[model samples]
Target: MSFITLNITCSEEKRELLIAELSLFPFDAFEETETGLLISCEEADWEEEPVFAVLARYEVECRVERVEKVNWNEEWEKNYDPVIVEDQCIVRATFHEPRPDFPYEIIITPKMSFGTGHHATTYQVLKHQLQLDHKGKKVLDVGCGTGALAIMAHKRGATDITAVDIDEWCIENSEENFSLNGCDHVKLSLGGIETVQENDPFDIILANINKNVLLDQIGAYSERLKNKGTLVLSGFYTEDIADLMAEAGKFGLVHQEQTERNRWAMLALKKE
Candidate 1:
């Protein structure tokens, strides 16, 4: 199926805000470029009036342009590259070179969207995953885009691990990556936390989804977590931490640790 590509070039101060705003839409995929942002949704006619309204809120000037239809999958694979973080892990495109030095390797074909691990949310989870004692423990990675963290946990010694994402492409890419990294035991599933019914009472639950999603499912994590289990959450700005903490407290979860990079934040909590 063909898709519409919306290209918007705005100022640096407004780029992040615009991206966050666009995320509310169900875009097939999106990318942030040096000059602006590019968004793709199933072929549709976008009224510039609404876009202009959104821009006015931020007082940012934007220029829109149309580009030729292209195969987004092929383009993403061609542009995707292995991203190494903290010299301990590597997030690579299936088509690129792999580095053995990274104890954990995640093979992700970004496709229309997802993966890349450059986002602070993914990086935060990756960093905290290193600090976990996954030695033969059962782990669950909810919203496992590209399965980067799930693969890492397996490599780190978590024998039974499951990675779930709503995107079918992400599930497919993650499976290919699991095999590529010699981590075949890790299960990849579609859907949200509901797929976790097959496996329950996990020793650790890792969720790096947005704030709203996290809050909605916070109870599910608490219910499925083994006593004394750990829950690591990211994908929200630092300012939103307070609200998360409040909600988590209701689930008997207390903040144990936190890490921040750029404007993103990660919180580690333990179930009482």
Candidate 2:
């Protein structure tokens, strides 16, 4: 499907507010421009009502356009760069040279998928993954964009891994990436949490989806995790910690630690 782009010029304060509101909708990616925020999504999912409703609250200039027949990977290649997390992990594309120095390297061709280890949420999660133990363990990666987290778990020695996402493009892109990283054995599902066929509870669960999605799926996460298993989460601001922790607590998931970067937070919890 084609993609629609919205170029919104609003005040600095309003920029973030718009992002938060638009994120709740079907928008795929948001980029900050010199004038405002540039948001895009599949044309099939684009709705003018929500976009205009949010824009109506503030005084701003908005431009809507259709990007015809664009390839997500090509678009990404033109504007993307490699990301380094904690100086230990390097996320680079095939076009970039290898960095043999870093202990762990995740090569990604994100396409239309997220989680290139560039966003603060993704970076924080990957950094947290480095600190966790995955050796000979089973891992579940919810909202597995680009399959980065699952591949990292493999690099860290996870024996069995399952990754799930609701987007078909993401599932396709992630498969390419997993094969590129030599972890194609990682199972991938093309739907939400319910599509995950977890006959055995996981030892570690990684979820970097937004707050609302995380809240809705926390119970499922709880049921899928083995006792004392770890759950690492991100994709919400630092302030959302209380709400997330509260939801997790409802299912006996105890908060053990947290890390914040540029206002985005990653919380690690253990199932009790």
Candidate 3:
């Protein structure tokens, strides 16, 4: 299907508000670029409407431009290559050759979903997980896109692992990757944090979702965690750490450590 690409160049100060405005359009995907935001939408009925009408309502100055459409997945695979992290982990798409000596190996097939482990959120989670005792622990990976974090937990000797993603496609991809890595112990589920019913009081919980979702469900995580359980969270800007930390404190979660990579922050907390 051909997609309508709308490129808008605006000041960084107005970027967030412009994104909030454009989100109302029938956009299939949008990306934050160095200069502005790029939004792509499948052809809809409202072709003639001035996009500036909405932008003007929000007092945003943006330029609209058109671009040719191509299969995004194809373009992604062409650009997808192996990324080595911490000199200890290797991540690669299916077509790329992997280096052999990395202590940990994570294989990910490029899909529409996120969580390649190269993102700062996933990177910090993986690095933090390396510090813990995963041996025989029951882990729950919330928002387990591509099953990256859960697979690592299983590799670290997690006895039972539950991985969930809100997107069905992500769930399927994660399950496939888990099997690809010979990790049969990790369970895959398609749902949100609310789907975490069968498992409770987990020893470790990994949540690499955005700040809003994390804050809203912070209490649930604490309620479902065993005493002294650990919670690893990411997927937020560095400025958001203070608010997230405050919310987590209500659940008796104390910040143990944190890491910043590429302007994103991850927090490691323990339930007291």
* Candidate No. with top TM-score: 1
Clashes of 2: 0
Looking at candidate 1, the ten consecutive residues that score lowest on lDDT are: 107-116
Candidate-wise lDDT, in order = 0.77, 0.85, 0.77
Clashes of 1: 0
Supply the global lDDT for candidate 3: 0.77
lDDT tens readout by residue for model 1, 182-258: 87888878899976783468999999888999999999999889889999998888999999999999989998999
Off by over 4 Å in 1: 1-27, 32-36, 41-74, 77-81
- The deviation in Å at residue 183 for candidate 1 is 3.7
Model 2, 162-254: lDDT tens digits are 998987878998999999999968988888888775578999999998899999999998889999999999988889999999899899999
Q: Order of all candidates by TM-score, from best down to worst?
A: 1, 2, 3
Superior candidate under TM-score, 1 versus 3: 1
Once fitted onto the true fold, the runs of candidate 2 whose alpha carbons sit more than 4 angstroms away are 1-78
Off by over 4 Å in 3: 1-74
For candidate 2, the TM-score is 0.79
Cα-based lDDT at residue 129, candidate 1: 83
